[model samples]
Target chain A: MVDWIAAFSMPLIQNMFIVAAIACVLCGVVGTLVVVKRMVFVTGGIAHTTFGGVGMAYYLMSVFAVSWFTPMIGAAVFAVVSAVIMALPAVSRRMREDSVIGVLWSVGMALGVIFMSLMDRSVVTPRSFESILFGDILLVGNTELKIIAVVTIISLIVIATLFRDLQALTFDETHAKLSGINVTVMNVILYVIIAMTCVVALNVVGIVMVIALITIPAAMSNMFTESLKEMMIVSVILSLIMAFFGLIISIGVDIPPGATVSVTMGVLFVVAIVVKTAFGKITQGKME
Target chain B: MIPIEIKDLSAGYDGRAVFSNVNLELRDRDFLAVIGPNGGGKTTLFKVILGLINPMSGTVKVFGEEPVVSARKIGYVPQNENLDSEYPISAREVVLMGMRSKKGIRPFYSKEDKEAAERAMEYAEVIDFADSRISKLSGGQRQRVYLARALAPEPKILMLDEPTASLDPSMKDCTYDILRKLNKDGVAIMLITHDMSSISHDVKRVACMNHRLIVNDAPEITQEMIALGFHCVPELVHIGSCDCGGHNHG
Candidate 1:
């Protein structure tokens, strides 16, 4: 019912697809690790906490005229810093992990709200608020695409090089420690890549929806996978499918692409859970 | 050199020591069982020997070197933790994971690693489930997989933390048989257990710790060791006699 060729003809749509593919690969890989490590809450904390960096970047750019300080760079720095802080022995020893995360999550968003509010009216764009909070994937240019591509390439390389170590660490920490793998170093690497992927994911799904995009597809794939590698592969494919369809549906309905993608993924996740449960029950009945 | 040597060792958290004046040794092909109450510094001793925690005083050595310096010569299995049933790793994959170290960033496992994993799986009697999902296997099968993971590294000594805590009698015997076989193959074995019920027939040396070490060189667990190490020993309702009040020997 839609003009498919006409949609593909648009440079904006093409660019959106490119960025979504790269970002999804990044998200899918990191999200799989986060899920396996039972650290979805950690990634959620990283994504939301990085918003403080975004607000800080805006503050510097607007008031101090620091043109070189981009919001993406700020997000990356903040994410890594937040992850390292959480990994610190002192912080973990003194406070409950969830408590630290909850505090950071709230304070970061609040800071972003205040910073944006204090910005000059002239500096504020018509779509900045909506786009930054929820994504405007269509607005991503070559520069944004290039940055995400580089990040994805580098992250994938690091993940590949350390895949075995990461597997051991995630599979069993005590065993990994006994086997001579530095558990601390592996945790640092996993968190660093997770934070960086979250920074790139922000451009596609924004701060509020970044967690869902990174988590849902991988989680959905996780339901059907028999291995970590299989989970990531399927997760990346599912993410691509979801992103493309969500974009089409959003364009058709004039809704936000980020919200559309999130809703679509959420619906699929519920359906997958239902089917998995039903299948399991059926098999159990047969065996009995 | 002795596989593990601890002399007058004391370890704890903060500035205060939890247990002190400890002396122990793990010799070649030794099957030693360390038993005590929970929170009686059993895990602390394991940590100290694994170089995870520094001893407050005295010394601990592995192969005549510091614990950290010779850590690679030992394979360790902690208390059974349920790996996420949803995690989709195979038994063989789990075995292969043990071949990794912090030495270098190698992306793929070599053929030698695969062969070593296969051999370990065979040794642990888990080759039957090597291709199966780890979570799909039974408890005994899963335990073997974990054992295979420990064996994959081919260490000179094996340290286990309550390995039979959750297993049934038959499975426990099977695990003990495997440990005995591994011991015969020239690997020193050190096991930590909270109860004597799980201690197998082949465990010859015993150590108990409440606030201090009580090493029993003989084959039996003496009443004095139980009285000092455990707070309240369990009474056996099945038989007329209590378990910890007399000598435990087969």
Candidate 2:
């Protein structure tokens, strides 16, 4: 037992824990906004569209020998830009929002596949695609953990400073606009924040399950709290617990941490819904 | 002084004109009721005044400034349109939003703001439900709460779209009583409704609209005018005698 614990205490495992904790915090905070604003679909759209950025980064990496951060930066930029474009008045007017998201999703997948086909034949490996799909938690080095820490801290500060504005905007957009809150600007800022969260969380939850990480905990928290601030705190705690449990389970069973985290969150969500309903029925029965 | 003035205003949606070349003026303390048919442009006119949509070619001013620039002096009550009642918001919080529009980024409501909101709630008779969740209120009660929210801003002009649309007879009377009192308190009221007969007794002026300003007259709707303006013969319509009991219309 002591030998196993020592083996798990390596720098790689420590780095993974730190990076996962930061990603969980960031997703929990921003996920509350996404749930309240009914932007789960938009977050899904950005998540899928990030593949285009990955493709762009891969194509440029061979030519310029850029670092690993280049892909994440490209993904963040594309996600934010695509989100803003979809939200533009003209695009929203010309096409239904869901249809626009569908178009972007297909285009992004196509671009990613084409770029993969064009990659150097010798470098073609199953693990490279696996990293994009399921993520490689073992790759979270100290530098990656530091980057995640900085992003998580900045996100926390920004959300705290604009808490009131975000609350007002989420509850009622017209009222927020009338209050001179610049609803458009605030919405853009929120999209940018969500985009950054998507990029950061992609490393932990992977691209396919990013929205699940961003939505499940928040949805679970909503069943218990009415206040937005309280919901956010509860969601953050729940996500952190899930992340820790996922890491432990993955270490014990040799399963992927992302899959473990998502499955745990799903089970928690179902359990929360059942408990809430049972409690509600019990209270009503007692009142009667 | 006139708080709102529209001249040669033509507005529409999707390139199809709803109304054209409509001219109107709204003076201070004036309660003007815009009565029109289903496809008429009553709501469109209000949207235009609120600067939500632009007229194809015309000019509109609120308090001698463009309606968009002078939004501070105007409070709007949209029709009892379908709102997601499941949204967790209290009635007091809804009214507080009115004050927020006027006092942006103040961090806290002033004493004067609270007093004004309380007074508005009293006027709308929604004080009892101030702490209640908005979703729990009935249609009439919710309308009153919305009115209180509009009045919280203490605007010189208040515009409502079909405030009595879905109410029963008793609820309609109660709503009109509140509106009449608000009008008496010198808050200019602009109501858009299809229930012309219901509001004819309370408002002094009625503007009949179709694709244009058909008529902007005092509460003197005659059977002949209804026939001409609506292009339909009345079915057992009763034209009442005026308040002075001297001018009766048939």
Candidate 3:
């Protein structure tokens, strides 16, 4: 088994493991903000919008030579901008928030489809498009792994430095504002971090399942912990473990890693819920 | 000294006005309970004071400075509207957030800050539930936790929007008693309440507000005053009855 594991020929598969590990760690850190702010839907909105950026990059690459990092950077910037717009009217008018999110989600998906359709068929292959949709782990290179590592480290540092402020904003905005914290600034910072996570996870999980990878682990961890710090730690551990297991299984079965990872997270969430319910009932019985 | 002064303040939402040409002065240590009908703009007026919403035209001054400029000096307890009850945060953590707006990016809480939070919890009578999750608390306990969170900043002026709404009679009394005690301790309070009869005896003054302001001098409310304050519209008066059982409306 050790010799077989060593015999794995593809360098891209090693890079894929490195990239997935980095992405999972980053998701664990930044996903806490998305969960605490109740911005799970907003993160979904941003993830969907990133497809438009991907389409734009693909179309532009046909005419102008573009590096691999260009599309990811473009997608990250677009996602952050979309997050800012979502936060604006949503924060001001309480009633129109959901409607605004829905409209933005539809617009983003529509823009992605339109841009993809406009691209020349000869330059942008259907298989390449399929790779973008479901993610191709075998395509991850050393450069992608490096980028993910830098992003994960920076995001973790920022989150650590601003953890208290984020906690305050998450628990109570008005109270945070009254204490002299600029609630708007904190919210914008959070969205930017979330956008970065979306961009990083896009390569690993694809657009459709990025939100699940970001939210599900956090939600599952919530069943076991009370403190935000504990929730974040548990969430990261859960995400990494799930990612490792999913990658191994995908390699064995020759299946898509993103779908496997998402399914693993979903299973974990269901198990968490059931176990939490049973434990709660046992505690109640003991109390009686 | 008057911590808050509203001079000829006429405020409302959209294009229509709720209260117009209103004048009020809240001195330090004044626990002014704003008792009026349901659609009377009491909460709107407080929102205007808090700078959450701008008044169509009027001046609101806190400590002789604009309300927006001196936001730190004032704390607010908003009505419990759509707060996810199942959110996993402790009561102490909630109260600690009150200091976050002032602390900014300090990244660490000082001994003084922790003590202030503890004192606020004690003042709000929720110190016992400090480690408990907010979702686990009862309505009365949750209300106190929110109050503790607001008071954690040690603001000179505290504004509440319907603090007693949907609470039991005993809970309402307990909340009011705590407010009365805070007022005595020199924190000027502006409470927007629908429970007029219960709060009328405790408050020093009352203002009847609807589409416009009608500042009344009398301590006790009368049926005639309710008629004039609500613009004598039978439909508007009918809506007021559903709020607190026609206590202030006769």
Candidate 4:
């Protein structure tokens, strides 16, 4: 049997557990709105743009000697700016959202690689660079963990306060606007919130794979729950379960936790589909 | 203040105009019907009146104030509107959303707000499934929930954009009956429809639209008006009567 106590004693493993919980909460809250708003593609666009932020953080830290601009802070700022650009009606009206996303996606990735190339090798170690793309929970330090926690708490609070407005907007915009919610402003705020989440969740799933964490659990919960409130609760719980188990299993197997976690949820989502479909068919047969 | 007053209105998307040089003046207790073809700019007119889009050139007033300021006084149901089938919501919550204008910036509902939602749900005949998931309900049931949501605000005017577009004939009748009841109770109604059969006794006025609007005082359907508004006669079985009931076509 594995020495569970010894594993728990390790500070690195302990940090991994903490990240699992916080990241799950962050994912659950933002993800439910993203899926409901049919903004998965928009989210996917933001997730990729965050890599540009990570690269800029590293570049500014080493080259420009900006000590305060950590990757999380830099990513947060970059993400918000990008999200606002994406949210702008001017941008959408001038060009299709799909085309805009494509442009931003390519530019962000290219910028990331170019910025990494300019950085000193000592600052851009292969493992650390890889960590920016596909996350490693072991890479998170005390500061990163604190940033993730603070951001997650703030996100949760905002979601709680504006839950009604977001709910109405997501379900039907025309009605929400008539009911006195500023639809355009609410949309921009929601986008900014999701962008910050993408930054905070970087250590858990990294930039490239972040959309899976943001979408999978909420979509899975949608199968079981009817109300947005219950769906959010169920989704958070489901995300926590996936994050915890995925962390432990990856630790045991000596694999990448981010990849393992994403795979775990992806598989569970398929299982849910199969179970729901089979159950539906069986009930229909019984009725017949 | 007139409930709705518009003059020389020209509105559309981009640089093109959908409808131009239109005018309207709604009475305090109007039961007006606006008729137009599918692409003849019915929805754009609503957008202008709802303060969703700025008009290229015109003036619009709701209850003597700018439409944006008086938007709360109106309850609107958009055309062919459907929430995501898998969306996480219930009828009661949707109904409560109607009361948002009353409690601005305060997200939580008060006791009175909850009671109003109840009254709306009862009126719409959807109290039985008030707790049911919106996605779980059938088409007709979902329409009633939308109606309940609109009615909960207790607006001075109710605007419905093809509210019964998806319903069967019987459901359409029920929807019109509810609208008539609301009108009789002194709430003005502004409904958009493509159906000529809606030229009924309850409608006090008719506005036909193509690239412009013509407000008809006599609530009667004329072949000339149909030809002008629709741009062409609809290619259907013109049995001289509408399919829903024995409403005349000629």
Which candidate tops DockQ? 4
Clashes of each: 0, 0, 7, 0
Runs in model 4 with CA error above 4 Å? A122-127, A285-288, B231-250
Instruction: Give one digit per residue, the lDDT tens place, for model 3 in A97-178.
Output: 6666677677877776776687676764533656776777677667667777888889888888988888877866766666
TM-score-based ranking: 4, 1, 3, 2
lDDT for position A155 in model 4? 84
Give lDDT: candidate 1, residue B233.
68
Which segments of candidate 2 are over 4 A away from where they belong?
A1-10, A121-127, B106-119, B127-132, B168-170, B195-197, B220-250
Q: By lDDT, is 3 or 4 better?
A: 4
- Each prediction's DockQ? 0.56, 0.27, 0.49, 0.71
* Per-residue lDDT over A1-288 for candidate 2, one digit per residue giving the tens place of the 0 to 100 score: 235577477877887888888898889889988987888988988887887787767766654455463567667767888788776768876788899888877887677777666655454232376777667777766666777788778888888887767777787675566566777778877887888888788888777889888999988887786466777889889999988888788877878888888898998899999999999899879968
CA shift at A11, candidate 2, in angstroms?
Answer: 3.9
User: Against the hidden reference, what TM-scores do the models get?
Assistant: 0.93, 0.87, 0.89, 0.94
For candidate 3, the C-alpha RMSD (Å) to the true structure equals 5.5
Best TM-score among the predictions, by candidate number: 4
lDDT of 4 by residue, A1-288 (tens): 568899999999999889878988888989999999989888888888877777777888778888797777767877898899988878866898989888888788788788777876565443366788888888889988988888888888888899899998898887788778987798898999999888877789888788889899999998888888888888899999988888888878878999999999999999999998998889779968
The CAPRI class of candidate 4 is: medium
Each model's fnat?
0.80, 0.18, 0.67, 0.84
